[model samples]
Target: MCIGIPGKIIALHPQQADCAWADVCGMRREVNIALIAEGDRQQLIGCWVLIHVGFALSKLDEQEAQETLAALHAMEEVEADVAMFLGAGEKR
Candidate 1:
């Protein structure tokens, strides 16, 4: 399934106008912001964005971002539980 992850804009890339650094769960990655770029890039710092395939799809409010992150974390836990169950079944 295709999923968009929420990330916070950390800083604007020095040489790339359409690219910026985003913090995704503690990891920083270069994300293309051309789709949502407007006005001053500095203003985007601290803003949350929905990212997909290295591109920032849209800007999200802090509350929405946090909710999405929480959902994603829940899904991760579910996946871990499923994996453990399957591993146990294989040992049977």
Candidate 2:
């Protein structure tokens, strides 16, 4: 399944007019915002966006972004548990 991670726009890219820097789960990444770049690009700062494959798919509200982040983190925990269980079985 393809997952779109939610991130907050921190700043616009210095050199790339169509790109911006986002803070995703505490990591900074440059994402293309051309798809969602509407009016003033500077206005996008501090806004939440759903990102997939280095592109901003759509803008999101703070509440929605928080909820999505929580869900993704929970999925990570579940995946880790499943991996541990499968690895244990292989040792038998």
TM-score of each: 0.83, 0.84
| Total clashing pairs for each candidate | 0, 0
Report the lDDT of model 1 for residue 42.
92
RMSD of each: 8.6, 8.5
- In candidate 1, what are the lDDT values of residues 21-51, reduced to their tens digit? 9887776778899999999989999999998
Q: In model 1, where do residues sit more than 4 Å from their true spots?
A: 80-92
- In Å, residue 65's CA in model 1 sits off its true spot by 0.4
Tens-place lDDT digits, model 2, residues 20-39: 98888776878899999998
